[model samples]
Target chain A: MPGNPAVPVAGNRFCIVGGASLVGSATAGELLDHGAAEVVLFDNFAFGSDAAIAHLKDHPRLRLVRGDVMRMANLLRATEGMAGVLQLAAYMTLSMDRDPWGGLDVNIRGVQNALEACRANKVQKVVFASSNAVYGYGPGVSGDLVEGTPFHSVGAPPAAILYGASKIIGEQLCRDAFRKWGQDYVILRYSTVYGERQHYRAANALYIIETYDAVRRGEAPKVFGDGSETKHFVYVGDLARANRMAFESQATDVAVNTSGPAPITTLELVRLVTELAGGGPEPIFVGNEPGKVRLTSGGAFRIAHEEAFRAIGWTPEVDMKEGLRRLIAWRESNEGRAAA
Target chain B: MPGNPAVPVAGNRFCIVGGASLVGSATAGELLDHGAAEVVLFDNFAFGSDAAIAHLKDHPRLRLVRGDVMRMANLLRATEGMAGVLQLAAYMTLSMDRDPWGGLDVNIRGVQNALEACRANKVQKVVFASSNAVYGYGPGVSGDLVEGTPFHSVGAPPAAILYGASKIIGEQLCRDAFRKWGQDYVILRYSTVYGERQHYRAANALYIIETYDAVRRGEAPKVFGDGSETKHFVYVGDLARANRMAFESQATDVAVNTSGPAPITTLELVRLVTELAGGGPEPIFVGNEPGKVRLTSGGAFRIAHEEAFRAIGWTPEVDMKEGLRRLIAWRESNEGRAAA
Candidate 1:
């Protein structure tokens, strides 16, 4: 708290934990493009696919470290001499439903290990990748979801609640580290992220890819329920910029939403995806999937990102149309289809 | 879901994980009095004390098993042949703040281990001791904290949020087990407990013991803030009975609050404790103790236990005054002083 908390990108070294996936790869490129001296991508390649980071593998300034967050030595060694660490390793709801033990271990203890490594190595700042899932799911989740919104889990599935609570615990672990050891940090509560390098693991963002695939196959895109449920998302590039801004800003010990400019309904999203994918038949409405873990909200809500501007002077630059268009183009590309 | 979910105590066997403590001892006695064939008390005694369960040690129906919840083998062996298992092994906010590494392991993974053990053993019912902290802290938490109340963490200390979120994860693990393996469970969201065998570890319940100690030393009891902060507590005996009722009822995969008849403000609670501990000086208003973990609520709230009545035909019979009177009586007795 005594001196400036911001770490300049140029000539500085950074490490991205779980940096082989969608947001991680984007943020790594953003940091590298900004003249970072060295950018290390630490991943165990468990959920992280090699195809996701193939573009960056040959970059001279980028180094990929094969490591697991559950192991302290991996984090300690990878984080040594780093100026900042972007902790992005986690299991979203789908993977959590399949394996909660591994998810909780990575989400909770993984964050703890990352922070401890930062402390041990004297890393200047940590920009932790949190999620708007911290606001939780259910009827109680509606309206503007600011950083202070309580987690609502009344009717949410177990895996969804587990994922949200684990994120909440992860954020608090950062706060605990800050209070206990003055480990500077900024928590970015990202909404569903979409765009180039979009992954299929996220429950909400999967709708985009699934709808695109259906449209490509000349099948009608499917929308669950009335399709009036709100879905807020940020472009991966915008999130990448936000992660960079978090390190460049003087913000520390704060958490803020980093959502897109506005919200979209499921119906609108499907229609948009259909149109963007060239052409498609009329969409069909369907009931909930029987055994699939789906995240449902009681009412429409928007994850506000004004606090991100105030805390780190960052804002979403990509609209849904533009972001989804990028995602479609990527899906048509060899790299994206290979990842798919 | 096929057979009777209820496991009657008269001819059944039970295991209490983290059993050598306040609620554990009280619930152990309740089961024995109800004619349980055998009751196993499993504990690591890390935070649990020997004096806490001394009175129940010699009972012919009770047996103590030294074990750690972290070790799956310990839980697997202890939970074998058990009809019902009450998981009370956890770190409150104070202990969580001290050692989060251990706390997360015990609270999150420990619950997973217990549920896994129960599933492997084909245990009929699991009574998980979740806390009203799942409702969370800060201003968003106020008025009628029913079973569905969302968790609010704005302006709360990190330790408190971590503790609350850990409990949320624990409950979801129970739900996850029920969904995955048909593991029958009843999650009781207990409020702060105060009665004959009270402990000093809980942030809110420690108020009673601290006030009693101050009054006993002829010093004015201390009240933090304006002392209007609400504190809702269930009697330890009532919780014990609720545990029994939970197992005896046919309810499965249900969570309900188990609070007292009502809530009391800090000032009223301090004064009541002072009165119960013989005549004492006027209570002193003081600011929060620096560097100490204190759970401060944003506004007045009551943890409604009405759902418990509906779910398991259980209701709190003890109010603040009576619960405090029993605590006072115990404090003056030989066993309580010896533990103190």
Candidate 2:
């Protein structure tokens, strides 16, 4: 049923680095579903979920290799004979801010290692997973966050955060690699992606998942900010499809913004999850935020997605309402399986 | 003589990475002449000439260490307790074009290793040896170069040429190190530098020095490119002084052009060398026919060196005519010593 002419026919090998993570796993699934002959998942298990890896274990076309990207030998070995590489292995966002050394080692050095391997292996294309955090809260609407925007994150609040700076540096690495190697590459700057398999301990996606779980358990869903801040919450499945589209598109110089078309306010998202969970409990809004506050909401993050759609002839099939329902259902099924 | 009211009166310690090379050795001498308390020369002798290292071995305040910058342990050991670092150790212009792997490994990875050492050692100032070759031959004026011109370089040139791209990448590395670590760094984008102790076999400087030697031996000097091509030649001593000034400057943002005040036409330069060599031979100007012409001779590679001069009170006292005469004398003396 996933027959699409744009999707490369089966027997074409595709390798997804960091394939055991939320995005990586979904990308792997999409590639296999679209008839890739074989999908090799390369990951070091740093932040990748075991369940995601286990779910794909039974797929005939999927193979898993546990490896770190920092080691060039390992990446080269895994990338040998691969047709294309989707580099998704990277340090966690929170990890970047806390452990800058690890972040640089993994993000910058690791990415270079991957590129070197790809170049050596004669890989046809490389798709890098970048982030919207590189935007660092556009300067009013006029900033309009274009690809060519001279990144002025020098004194920005996010620049002070190591995670955002790593993303910026990663983008620079991609640009340099393109300039130097002329390799067909695409940078997917994903927004706040959330869905099943997201770690409940992580900040962005965990907040929503834990809040819904708490409300269902007859506890209040706690909110950090004034409940007025907003962000674009893209479903992980949709992000995976976007990556697939990018791989299929012939566009060489592409850095598509992958996010939900509709920007959902944090408070509204919480309320919708609570409603979907059958009016479990009221959300306890903790007024006044502590950490960095970037209300990068509304239609601002949607611009790149529009560009992505026009370029690849693709769109997100799952809306927030249905996406949330699917997440809640997955959570319930997992809970039931645990109880049994 | 090297007193600067800008740099505090306390003696300054400097670490010169790859300090055994022509540029590094020259820079070391300049620093010593300007009154640096101590200078440490770090190199693995990868491409550094042994004679250059031996020449400075007797200096009272200078020390030498055999170590590669690619090894983090070696870099850390070499840089420990230094107040300033002058990084000049790199694969030469012709070498980079031949072995790109070695070029990337040494130029990019080697730079990172040095920077990591600098951060660990708490080195106060970093003066990176960059090149104007990064600008690739500009239009109109042969030497009318500026700091803001766009970079252009095709793969390795006639001689395996990773030097240009490596310098460009090196500049990026410095920028990243500054942004991430807040370490003060100055990128010295140098033009064709020549003086005593420089090897006579290298391409650019070799042509000039060989011409001088041939004239001294009563042989005709050959000129390529119609005698119209020009080059900006800074005396090695002046470049060394610039390094000192860069180290002493308090400004964090620093990337300045450093070249001789006068642009030397290839033909006129040969004539001056002929006269300096006691008028042994006239130069034969070959017309502007090109097989592999490095036609960067005319116009202004001269930048606002006044910025550096004001900052550190550095003045190039060695004029080209006197400098060439001195170079010929040094070469003759060295040959005599070798024969003895």
**lDDT (tens digit, per residue) of candidate 1 on A250-291:** 999999999999999999999999888888899999998898
Model 2 residue A300 CA deviation in Å: 6.1
CAPRI quality of model 1: high
Q: What is the lDDT of residue B8 in candidate 2?
A: 29
For B1-340, candidate 1 gives per-residue lDDT tens digits of: 4457889999899999999999999999999999999999999999888888989899999999999999999999999999999999999999999999999999999999999999999999999999999988888889999988899999899889999999999999999898888899999999998888788888888888988998999999999999999999999999999999999999999999999998999999888888788889999899989998888888889998889999999999988888888888898899888878
Which predicted model would earn the best DockQ? Answer: 1
Clash list (residue pairs), candidate 1 = none
Q: Per-residue lDDT tens digits of candidate 2, residues B166-230?
A: 56556656766776677778888887778777674356787777787677667889998667566
What is the RMSD, in Å, between candidate 2 and the native fold over all Cα? Answer: 8.4
In candidate 1, which residue ranges exceed 4 Å CA deviation?
none
Mark the 10 consecutive residues where model 2 chain B has the least summed lDDT.
B1-10
Model 2, B277: alpha-carbon shift in Å?
17
